[model samples]
Structure formats: structure tokens, C-alpha cells
Target: MSGERRESGDVRGILHPGEQARHRRLTRLTVGPALSAFADRYWVVRWDLRGRPAYRAEVLSFPCVNVTFERSDLRTGGFVNGVCTTKYVRELSGEGETFGIRFTPGGFGAFTGMDVGVLRDDSAPLAEVLPAAAGLAERVLAEPSDERRCGLIEEFFAGRGRAGDPHFALVSRIVTAMAEDPDLTRVDQVTARFGVPVRTLQRLFRRYVGAGPKWVLCRFRLQDAADRLARGDRVDLAELATDLGYFDQAHFTREFTAEIGMAPSEYARAASPGQSVAR
Candidate 1:
């Protein structure tokens, strides 16, 4: 996904410009798998987005699908469904768009009663499961009620008998902590907080989240920082590193590049509009 652009009013939308003035606008209707009492799952509500002239997106994962309701000889309509982890990018064209939904890592498990790792393979097409999923999305979007939305999610899990997954509980606690303090958190910190050993924590992460604890913490922390910078915040990289529990700027830079594919200064330059070069 490219940089996100916010929409006005109660709606959320993002626009990604292509090679020309042509752009794609994704207007979200009711996107949210609002945090719930449920264990490890998180539902990203549905959205109704309209593409402008044309654009493309790299399919990073298959947890999300594009449901096309209309199409012409020049265009097409139907939903792209599946759970995927492999990166697949695609160029998109045409106008008039609609809504889509995403099930977070464990969220898919809650909805499908399958192991979260099942989605790690990008080959699976979730198309077989769309009828039920789309029906649920439409109902929730029409009513815009959290209670009903969560009820549907819970019901899905109940059917799968997945409410008692060990991995779900572990990931839930870890995700919650990351959300609370992305900067001041680490695997050690999480283990201490949860009263578990480092080895145990890593096991849980691998079993459920499909990544290591360190990777998860690092990803979310960097993403949090990117979000702040994207929204026009002035950030001091060195201070940011220290505040986020890194030993120094050098360590922070190394990890940032490893995960984001760019050094801190380079990332800041590309992400920030007028930020000065790092000294």
C-alpha cells in the first residue's frame, strides 16, 4: 500500500497518485474491527472506495479483498478473496468503486476458525468464503453498530470453537501492549509484563503471529513513528531511539532499515516534505 490520505467527515479515505495526475481514491465506509474483549482477533471494518482514473497496488497479503459490484466490457466486477502473506502488487484502473474488509492476523482465525498461519501462504483464494463474509459486511455497514458487528465476529469464532486458542490469548496481550507504548516496549518488556520467559514468548509469537516477537515490536514501533511523521510531526531520531528503548541512534537506524528497507535519514527524507538532512 502507498501513503494514506485521510478523507473528510465521519468517513476515512486514501488517495494514491500514479505516474500521471491520475489517482486512485479509496473512500472507507465503516472500516473497523474495533478492539473488543475477544482474544487475539481484530477486524478492519468494511470500506467503500472509488478509484479515480487508474492505479495499482502490490498485494502484500490476502487478508483483504476487492469486491466489485459493477463492471463494463472495459472493466470488471467481483470480489478478490483469500488470505495471503506473500507480496503481490497489481495495477488497478477504472472509476466507480465499492467497499472491502480486512481480517487482522488472528482476526481471520476468529472469522474462519482456521489456524492464523493458514494465511501465510499467498496462494489460498478466499473467494470460496465471500458470500457469508460479504453478507456480514453489508449488514454492519448499513447499521453502523459496533455491538452488532462484534456479535457477528464472535458468532463466527463460536462456530469455529476457536475461542480457546492458546495462541490467540498470547498474541492479544502482546498486541495490546504494543498499542499502549510502541516506543517503550520490547520482547523482554513484554515477557516481564506477561510473566513469561523469553523463550515462551518467542514460541507464542511464532505459533500465532507468524513472526518473532522482536520483529513484531519493531514493525509496530516503526509504523507508529511513520504515522507520526506522515501527519507532520517534527521528530528527533536520536531522541526517538532513546525514548523507544533503543541503545542509540546507530542501533535504531540499523533496525529501521532492516524492516523498512531504508535507512532512518533516507526514510525521513522520503517521508517528510521539508525536513532538513540529518546531521
Candidate 2:
């Protein structure tokens, strides 16, 4: 499956895990991070299969909300469709079967006046949220008009206000920095930069992000490396290991495989042009 583009109405799609031939589609007005053009006019759909040893035979249905943090679970079943203002990072297993449809970043701004975040780790009840989102997905898949779609999203967030308690502004700053540049900074460095104690910083991360500073940083760094590989950037895996704060090439590969469920070379091949893998 090399370089074959599929056309489905106004959506153009691509599949990921080229070798396995899994069925996941990404439909968006544009491909990259720039979302200025579609501000107040679009939304995104994502079906993440981040964790699952093999393809599972369950279909997930859930309500849509905005997600701002990275999720690192080996998920198998679920479908996500909604508008979000934050970045998403996930690790997939079980053949990497998932689909996504993204609206322009600015497209949903008018609708979701407030930002939303959803986390469904082992602690949360996936069954409840998945069903709610599934109902919304049925409406979205019906091919509603742009204005109607935006209105539905707006109502969804309006009903669900902020999902959790608000942390201090300092915590927000730290999380944003980790999301933006995971490798350039460290937990000790964050404390030093903000003049806070390490324990205090760790507490902030745990309370707000559900993970410690080091775990968040490593996840983002792996995402950065994955993005580079997806876009066909060639770098010495060994050098990338050192630059991204890994112990060595072997260490990097091990971490990458554990998180991404595939070796770097395998991912690269799957993402190559004409391959079925999603970018």
C-alpha cells in the first residue's frame, strides 16, 4: 500500500501500521499544527488503540471533550470524536488500529469557549464515558453541516464545564513547558527554574497531570522523536538517543518500542510514502 490516497466525501484518509493493514483513518482540513484558518469552524475525531497486544473485537462509543495532556496507555477499543485545544500523545499496541478526524485548530474555538481535558486511565470508568461519546459520534457521522456540528460541540462542553479542580498557575506553566520541550528541561531544572522545591514540584505534577515530571518529559520526548520519524527525518538513532537524554541507542530503541510498540525502522517503513500508516 504505497501512496494510494482514499477519497471519502470531503474527507481524505490514510491508514496506519502499513504492514498489518489495520483500518484507521485521519480526516482533516489540513495535516499539521497550524489551525488559524479553520478557527470556529471545525472539529477532530480520534480512535486511539494505544494499548492492545492484538486487535480486539470491541467497538468503543464515547462523548467528546477537549484533551490537553498526553495519554500513554496500550488501549485497544474506543472511538473519540470532538474538539480539543490541547496536544495529544498516546502509545498504541495490538496492531495499531485507530482512526482520527481533526477539525482545524481554530475551528472549534468559538464553540468550546473553555478548554476541556479528559483522562481515562485505569482509575476512571471507561464504560460510562465511552457510551456518552458514542452517542455524539453517531450524530457527527451523520454528516451534519459545519454550523450544526460546532453547535453540538459547544453544547457538549457547556454541559460538562471543567472536568477537574484547577491547579495553580505554576503547574500549568510546568506542564506546558514539558509538552513543548520535554528534552530541553528536566524535573530538577523545572524546580530550579521556578525556584520551587523538588517535592513541591512533584506534588504539583502528580495532582494535576496524573503523572510525575520525569514520566511526562520522557513521553513528550518520545513523541518528538516519533513525529520526526513519521515525517521522514533521518537521524542517527544513536545520536538521537544521546540528544533526547537516553542512555544510548539500545536504550532509545527499547524505550521507543515499549511506548510505540514498534522499532524505529519499522515505524519509518510503515510511515513511508505509499505506505498505509497514518502520519
Candidate 3:
């Protein structure tokens, strides 16, 4: 599975064309057994760039947390990454490998034993979050084979007891609906259709998903816009803005630039086939 496509099937909103090949080498697999109840998939990324200069891999993050084993120049180890509500960028140098368990929206609530919202835009050492499993990172990363690492993570989560909650399913439904429906770009659309009151929606998202429903809706909208532009579709800013529920083109450009790190027109040009981000 290409890293450019999230396990949720959303195309990554930010892609550095120079790094597309390496990203495609990523391995992603769905979880089996009860762990599947909590996670979307397990992913492994290994790259060996002995003579090549370092590259920065960027992706507009999805609204889910990850339990990961990674040895990097910066991280040097593993971490429990909370849901990131902004663009996520990782600079890559030398050779490194990472294995991650990508959770469904709100799926992390069970393992945390607390409101998942607190973890939004943050990451903690596994030891800190799950003291009993402080050593799991080293143990997992010790294995060179990604297949073994997958088993290790699966076994670890399987024994973690049943951390199931109805809220997990509820959150999944809410996020899935937003991702699937382009027309569902507004909070009121979700409120009126899903029957979740604004206050309740805000509280649940902050607790389970770590972002407000409005943020999640906008996130998906941006994802859609990015995917379309990446396909080389010539888009009109005003029309796109209206479709995305922005009041006007200026508002749309501001929000898209803030979230995606480039104006839509610029991103579209940079992502064209056979093009790469300028060095």
C-alpha cells in the first residue's frame, strides 16, 4: 500500500513528488482479531538512502493516533502518537524503518483509559502512556523484519484487555460520514443529519477524536480539494470555495493555505505528474 493513500482510503493531502517512489514502498496491512476493533491497519516503512541526500516527507495528517516503533535520526525510538490535527512533516536522512498501528478515529480511547481529546496534536513515549509496556518499543524495533514487528504489536494490543466502548463506533460513523460525503461540509449538516447536537458533538470529538467536529469536517474537505487538484483538475477557486462551504474565495484560500502549507493553485502545479517539489 502506498503511504500516499491513507488506510482510510483518503489520498494524502500533501505529497512531495520527489519522495513518491519511496512512499509507495510502504507496507500496510489490516489488523485481524480484536485489535482490528481498535485499529485501522498496521504499516511498515523502511528506506535505505545510503548515497542520496535526505528528503522531507510531508502529509496532511489524518485525525487518528498511532502506536509506532520507529528509529530515526531525531526520534531514535518509538512513540505513542496522538491524533495530529495539522500538517505532519518528517525529515528523513540515512536509513531507517518504522512500524505503526494506525487507529480509526476515536479508536484510541480504549487503550488510553481517558478522553482521547487530550492526546490531540501530541505524542508521548509509550512508557509514559502505558508504563507496563515501556520496553515494548525497543523489543519491537530490535527485530529487523517488519512482519515480526507486526506480530509483536498485534500480540501486545491483543493482551491489553478489551478496551471497547460504544463511543468508538459512534466516532467512527461520524468521521466516515464526513469523509464519504463532500456535501457534508458544515457542522449543521452533521448535526441535522446525524442528530448529534453541537455541544455533544464538540464534547465527543474533543474527548475521543481530539478535534472539534468543525475541524474534522474542514479537514476532510481539504483532503477532497487536494486529491482533486493532485489529479491535475483545473479548478476555479470561487467554485471550489462555494462547494467546500467557504463563504468566498479569499476565505477558502486562507484556510487551505493554512492547512496545506501552500495555496491551492501552487500545490496543484507542484503535484502535477512528472513534477516534483522544487529543491
Overall lDDT per candidate, in order of appearance = 0.47, 0.44, 0.75
Where in model 1 is the C-alpha error above 4 Å? 1-22, 29-90, 94-98, 121-123, 127-161, 164-167
lDDT of 1 by residue, 1-279 (tens): 112233432111111112211243333333323323233222232222243434444322322323232232233333433433333344455433333444444554544454444334332323344445445444544545444544554464344434566667666767667756745467777877888888977766555555567766665565554444344356778877776677888887887666555676665566556665442
lDDT of 1 at 251: 89
Q: What is the lDDT of residue 256 in candidate 3?
A: 83
Cα-based TM-score, every candidate: 0.60, 0.53, 0.87
196 Cα displacement, candidate 1 (Å) = 2.5
Task: Please give the lDDT score at residue 77 for candidate 1.
Answer: 35
Candidate 2 lDDT for residue 48: 44
Better of 1 and 2 by TM-score: 1
User: Which digits, one per residue and each the tens of the lDDT, describe model 2 over residues 16-110?
Assistant: 32422343443333222232222211333333444634332211111122221112235433343342112223333323323233322212222
Poorest 10 consecutive residues of model 3 by lDDT? 1-10
Greater lDDT among 1 and 3 belongs to 3
lDDT of 3: 0.75
Q: What are the per-model C-alpha RMSD values against the true structure?
A: 7.3, 10.2, 4.0
Output the TM-score of candidate 1.
0.60
lDDT of 3 by residue, 123-182 (tens): 888788778777889989888766666677777767674565776668788899998887
Q: Report residue 206 deviation for candidate 2 (angstroms).
A: 2.8
